[model samples]
Target: MRKRLDFLSLNFLRKIEIRYRLINCFILVSLLPLLISGLLAYGETSSATQEKVRVYSMQVVKQISQNLLLRMEKIEDTSEELALSDRLQNLLTDYYGSDEAASAQARSGISKVLLDSYGSFPYVNQKYILDRKRQVIDPQIFAPLANSVARLAEEAPDLNGRPWWTLYNAGHGQRSLAMLREIRFTGNNRSAGLLFVGVRPSYFFRIFEGIDLGYDSSIFIVDANDGAIVVQNRETGPGNADPALQQGIAASLAQKRDADFIAYTGADKMPYYAAIARVPHTSWLVVSATPSDKLNADTRSVRNKILGIGLLCFAVSLLLSAIIARSITQPLKRLVMVMKETESGNSRIRVEQAGSDEIAVLARKFNEMASKLHQNKEQLEDQVAVRTRELERANRKLEALSATDGLTGVANRRRFDEALATELRRAARSNKPLALLMLDVDYFKKYNDRYGHQAGDECLRIVARVLQKSSRRATDLVARYGGEEFIIVVAESDPGGAIQQAENICDAIFELKIPHADSPFGYITASIGVAALQPDDHTAPERVLRIADQALYHAKYQGRNRVVLGSDTVHTL
Candidate 1:
């Protein structure tokens, strides 16, 4: 054996093993620093980039909101001027005689006056004058504008004399901001008519263009009242907005608060950092969004540079590791070869400890360690066998305790829940019926009060035994559900079969006839609720329990000591 082993245990193989170990250690030490530095650099860059993006986006949103408010103020001023005009008042006061020709002349004059007033303001899309009766006087100036007149009439119910501005959507994909003011004269202090000025949607669009959101960014106006996109630099298709994001925006608007840095997907399928600010003068939402990728572009560049430096360092370390590994492994090669030879029955070849360092000490210790290890091998085997037998016995005891209820000496809640879950799954898979009966001792608190606590415990144990005996099926399980409540799971049983079983259990408990002199209700009784499992995979384990609980509640309401089945027409019981 010694001669045969000398051929297989060569010196070269030992040197290769030592070289591989040294290389592994070098690689780990070199890469660890590089990994840590790269992670720290990436995290810092990402955090700074996110902060900068948030600050800039907030500034853009604020500036846009201010600009929109200014424009709305200008429109309001124009509306005030139009409402106080003398020409509009005169048109409202002049009521023609019932002659058709005179009425035509007065209508023509009124339309010309309104056209001139509207022409002064380029933002005004249309203008109208209504008489005291809310009838249009300048009908030609607002051609095919029936819908606009009707809406204004509805809005200005108290047309006695008041001015109000409202924003609304005009048909054909146009939104208009309009102001309606009642016209009055000195002698007739009451309102003679209403003056209206409608501003086109372009008025808002032109204001949104001045703000500089980067090339990939966009600014839009949404009508808060109707959730309509009023003016958009880049239009999002219908229903493309995230429902959760929209809900959040709506909630913010409802609360009359501003929403900042909300995440939303844009028309271009890119995620953006969005901020929504409500325009104070109108029910308009000014939204400014910038592509998140653009904001993080600088951080990504910094990360790439850091990774490049780390890779260079790693390459240099790897090269140095190879050189160091070769040097350290040369001496270990001889020691390892001698050890292999000794292990294979070549006892003459002894290792020579050459240095006064840890490695040399380790080489000397290896011989001593090998001899002691051989001596203790038999003892270790015996101890391992003894531990295995002990573990097996412990596992069996644990399994038995797991299945048996600690309180009632019957199946535990965990076992009952598991069995019911398995039966439910099987019933669903095989299209078979599964039923569960939940039973609770009626007036249990009263019983505990009349009798001592000890008697209450004994009563519960007796009830558990009766339930166990009543469910005679091999597949049936009786488990003590928390306190005085107990549950019985019956597999492959229909609603009728479950109900009969529950009734039998209730009767068996009554048959015990334990004397209860302090009981107001003659004898101790129980309420049983039974429910059949529906053959639906989505039906949860708790569904049967809930139904049974509901049935039990109904049984108590009807009268105690009665069994209630879930399938009965009287669902309350």
Candidate 2:
């Protein structure tokens, strides 16, 4: 009976292995076609998406460039109109008058001309005259030009008989693009002065309408002379130029060429694709950028769809595999359940086979295997538990040794230093006060020599206990700081409060009365130094420690058994 059962079990196990192999083969065969189809689909979609993105980006660039050029032309035309205005001509003649009354009357006439011309073109902002000396003749324009003339004088000393256009950084939150045209008066027909028309940035920014770029996308015009951004779409807010994008745009301007579609970080530290084009008529560059993800949205959608189809094909293959695997695994499921129950100390379950195939043979062998596994499980569990407990104990010992001071049974200097740094950082960020106390056992070496090394250990333990008890707050820490020295960190305490706490700890250690007959100082006690820190003193935690250490050195120098406070003069021990 046993032999027959063994043979049946072997045959059933062989049939299960065969079914597994067959299912694997089916999966491979099915997946190969699906994978190939997915790759081909993804490749086609990627190509199509890239092409679409290229076409769309090029179209956007062209449209934006045309729109900007048209706007610049309109501004140029308006500038020409101001240059030819009869009123502007009359105002320029009066502005160059020699006498104070004549100059005052000229200023009045020019202000009137500006008010009249400003009504026609609200974007004019201001209009003024530069005299033969290139000095601003209009009081309204004098403020921005007064300091700027010194700078411009260095750049261009002889501004006579010249028609020049330049951009200037106007004070009072304005940037002016000015055009200067040399004018000859009707009487002398000699160059008398220059006519200047200042256009505000809003005049150009008004053209950036009806564009559907993403919310983060921005369009800006920068002055080529100094690389300061002159005009940008106001809707983008101020300081929206990311340094990386600014550098890229500056490079493009320096090279005097358009940049490729490149990824860059924006002012907000978000990724974007940037392209720059130089303006034709001025020393200015136009930079247009959109979020990189927005530019590739269509491509991502197509790629997602292709991946989705691939997943669907994989899902169908898995479903078919489950159905085929179920036929061979049905009997094994019951056998597994019986085996699990047997493992839980119920070993009387008998295997039942549904068919006369190899499954029947496997069923009989499963019962015997379950019996053997059940017998060995207890011993295996015992060994595993013992090994786990030993490992856990070793880990605990390692952690304890890592944190503990070998000599004093308190936290070591390493742990104390880490805690002090962390607490100092926390106090700084929270704008709170923190204090440190340095304590040293008085005449520790004498005590060690009198009562031996074992007694020295007992003395350190007693001092550590006193320090631990004195510091009651959860934020307070007492640490053994090398041989015969200890330190305490007290958080959220002021100088006076820290001094009292340190004195209390000193008295506590003195009360312990550890024997030190051979010591220069009578009973065993500690000299303590206290220092407090405020939020503004961000110099380092170690600096505070150095201050406390200096105070402690003074304490030891004055006497051996008293507490000293940190101040302008270190308090005596």
Candidate 3:
């Protein structure tokens, strides 16, 4: 009986001990900390997600605005360039009251340039030039708009000598955007005529290509002066465009409320997040609207996840608190050290995932993150290097194309002008003599008349090669001044050396034996004018060019195939 009693006592004590341990665990692990932690995590994650969405939406709107501004600026710049071009200006200035052939020539040059410029920009639907006589150079362009709006662009008092934008109705309720620029003679800076550019609404479709936001989100451009939609995304249709929403947005933007997102309530009583950015150089605003529910959807998902994670962590902690002991501390410390190492620019550092517990999972995630970061760093570095190299190559190619003539493979007129100025400056400073040779094919117009223009071009190319070979010094420059006209600059050369070089150039062309039935020699030949001068600091490069030109005329007058010094003394080659 005593043994049976002792067994019962032992069983009772064991039951009590089990109950006590259960109470202790519950008290120690309590749901309070879990609820508090879940709430904190939910709050932090929601705020972060909301902030990120806000920033991302604003960036999208700003990017759209920047892109629109860039295209507008390009158009504006092209217009400025066309208006300021000397050849085009001369053509336009002479277009009025000119003969048919002259007018035809002017139109040809103008059209070629306009088409080439237009081809680079597909957004420009239609381009035309309205001359001083109010005649459209190109027929397919809008003549009526050119006659009316183009004139307004030139004479309107409200424009303040700036470009004007208008919306043209293209029937079927489709509208097109138009920019009108007043062309002026660069010589006089007075209004000469107008340049017209048209852009259809289709441009916007391509402008927003590859750009995406969440559902029910839309971006559009509107006139800042008046709330008129210039371009709208597909989502912002007539149904979605609420007058109340528009007015509220306009009001918010008018107040210059902030350079970030604003809260707006639409007519349907649904709240929206709106962002606005101004399109540079235009009275347009890029506006983006996102539904509040959609914007917060990510935050809501994070909140639910936080709650679940907190619950799971609470259960796991309760089970492992006593056994985990100091194991968690060491790995966590190691993880912290590795993170510090990664933060200190060592993305190759990784944590070991020794087990399948939460700590091990965390370590595995850290390792994965580090590996991805390292890969991304390498990839970004490679892309940057490649892009830098490509950009450098593109820039070099552009520079070469800009400075070199295409037809003759020599310096272009612009490059010649630049080099002449620099060389003159150098000679003036060093007190040295510089020589210039200006020459043209004898009876070149007759050559073009006898042979076709293509033959004439080939002859000119061959002549350029001969001139380049004659000027052997590295400091010498050979350039095509214009059609059938080439110029050579001999650095640090006296008049005698220049005359010798000119004679050589003349003899080389004569030896080519190219067919020129119209010439006195019955072969291709050249007339060169030599000008050498020790120019002072005040000497203009134009003065040297003018002297060379005068000598060239004297050479032509004296004989067909000879060289003339600056003093008009002829040297038979």
- Backbone clashes for every candidate come to 0, 3, 0
- What pairs collide in candidate 3? none
- Please give the lDDT score for candidate 3: 0.76
| Model 2 stretches astray by more than 4 angstroms | 1-51, 94-103, 140-146, 149-167, 173-190, 214-216, 234-243, 250-272, 293-298, 311-573
Residue pairs with clashing backbones, model 2: 8-361, 9-361, 242-267
Q: State each model's CA lDDT, in order.
A: 0.69, 0.68, 0.76
Angstrom error at residue 563, model 2: 81
Q: Model 3, 563: alpha-carbon shift in Å?
A: 48
Sort by TM-score, best first.
Answer: 3, 1, 2
In angstroms, give how far residue 221 of model 1 lies from its true place.
1.0
lDDT for each residue of candidate 3 in 1-573, tens digit (9 for 90 to 100): 645544433332223333454455567766777677767877787678667768887888889988887777777888878778887787786675458778777776676567556634546767778776646786334455556555544543344467777665543455678777778877777767777777766676656877777746887887765567788877343222457656766777678753557777887788887778777656677878888877777777777787777765665665333333234455678899999999999888788776545667788988888888977887899999999999999999999999888999999999999989999999999999999999989988779879989999999999999988988788889999887899999989998888998998999899999988988899999999888989889989877887787788668756768899887566777
Residue 28 in candidate 1 has what lDDT?
Answer: 65
TM-score of 1: 0.44
lDDT of 1 by residue, 371-427 (tens): 676667789999999999999999999998989878689888788879888888888
Error of 2 at 431 (Å): 70
Off by over 4 Å in 3: 1-43, 98-113, 119-121, 131-162, 201-216, 232-242, 256-258, 315-573
Off by over 4 Å in 1: 1-29, 95-105, 120-123, 141-144, 152-189, 235-243, 264-272, 291-294, 309-573
Q: 88, model 2: CA deviation in Å?
A: 3.1
